[model samples]
Target: MDTPSYRERLNRVLRYIENHLDDSPDLEALSAVACFSPYHFHRIFSAMVGESVAAYVRRLRLERAAMQLSLSDVTITQVALAAGYDSLDAFSRAFRAQFKVLPSAYRRNDGPLEQARRYSIGQPLFYHLAPDVPPIDVQIRSFAPMWVATLRYTGPYDDCYPAWETLMAAMQTQGLLTVDTFACAVSHDNPDITPVDKCRMEVCLSLPPGMTANTLAVRNLLQDKRIYLRVIGSNSDYAVIEVNGPYSLLHPAYRSLYWQWLPQSGREPDDDPGFEVYYNSPQSTEPQDLRTGIFIPLLMG
Candidate 1:
């Protein structure tokens, strides 16, 4: 299948899985959703998503159980069964293997933020915000649609520097980089749910107004470097937060936005993926001096 078509189909399957986590979706059912043959669907899904369908589903279910453990007063047995485990023993074994903590201990010791921190223990690029951190200031803004040249990286978040470097070098070599060039990173998976090594990230550089992927130069550049061109839709309303600090703070900032602020904001997030735009280069800026804008598209009536 062509890239865009396959991507769209897989994305549909992903949404279906997210919405129906309680159901055990078999390969044939999911393949039907993606319009791919059962024989090839698993291969395609594993290649594109960096995980087998079963692994993806199990990870999501476990992560959902974790959220329920921290956010609700549900019993361990209830959470385990809800997660599709046959018994508490089975659930405890699976949960401990993935999270390195017993359900009771995890629930007893952590809230949402603390749970986030616990999951991020080994990932140095992620950090949990202190409970005393100041309240986040959110602004609703409008963004125009734009085209971007993108390079994908699949690994730990902090290890994505090479993708940025390669993409920047390519753009500069193609005379596409300018003083006003807009750059952003698209995170395709939740680090909390997806294993760090399998996380997908896209480093993007906005194309000029009149430029497009079909342009001879852009097309050749993309083909030569195995990069992709994508169009980000305009958002009439997006809840945006300006983050000032190291990249490590981004994950927690997002958690704060989703778990803390969004619940009380009286608005829902649109389907578009959230992204971060950097205002300063990490190479030259102090860790504490870096500025980043986190944009979450908002649903509109």
Candidate 2:
């Protein structure tokens, strides 16, 4: 099947899920939305989206609940019930597991990043959050569609650096690395929602135009290494911010963008996962000197 066709079907499924979050749509109904068979839908959904259907729905529900808690005056029980939990105790347990705070506490706190700091005490990376974080500078930028070769790692975000090394080495051996190559990291799971041990990160390098997964050279290289080639489509409007410190700062930067800027900016984030473009190698550059660009896609009118 053509890649675009597959993507189109899955995108439809995503929209369907978002609009019907409270319904708790069954697998058969979701599969029909994507025009896929019930037996194969779960596997395809997980493979294409990087998470199972149930997990995706649950995360979206909790995320919505979080927005309501932070942005509105909704009661704890009401928020819990809206998130699909039958009991307040069950919702509180789930919320605390995801956000590290009970619904009431999260509502009272300044933001999720602030709450995360309490649990991360004594960690150097988290120390930056102690001081009041300055307002992040965001630029609206457009990006071109590009192809990237990626290596997927399933583990703690801190431990995924080796995956980048392995991917870069493999690409270099194939003579794919060049002066114009771009390196990026795609985070598939939110640390607050997914367990740290189960987080997924895809270390990626942009391939030169005309290089793709179907290329004979790339196909042969993938025979041994667990690498994937996919296209990142263009977006005319992306809320881009530059981070110029240790990687730990990225979490707060994102929090500021979503929790602080987004509501006031009059822009809505698209469903696509945001990605980070690294400008320098952490191995060579000092943590304070490293630079990264965070790109969050915006929904089109």
lDDT against the true structure, per candidate, is: 0.79, 0.77
Error of 1 at 201 (Å): 1.4
For model 1, residues 82-161, the per-residue Cα lDDT tens digits are: 99999999999999998888888878764454565466455421334544345578899987788998876778998999
Off by over 4 Å in 2: 1-105, 109-134
The C-alpha stretches of model 1 lying farther than 4 A from their native spots are 1-51, 60-97, 100-128, 131-133
Candidate of highest TM-score: 1
Give the alpha carbon lDDT tens digit for every residue of 100-161 in model 2.
87888777764464454454456432234435445578999987878888776768998988
lDDT of 2: 0.77
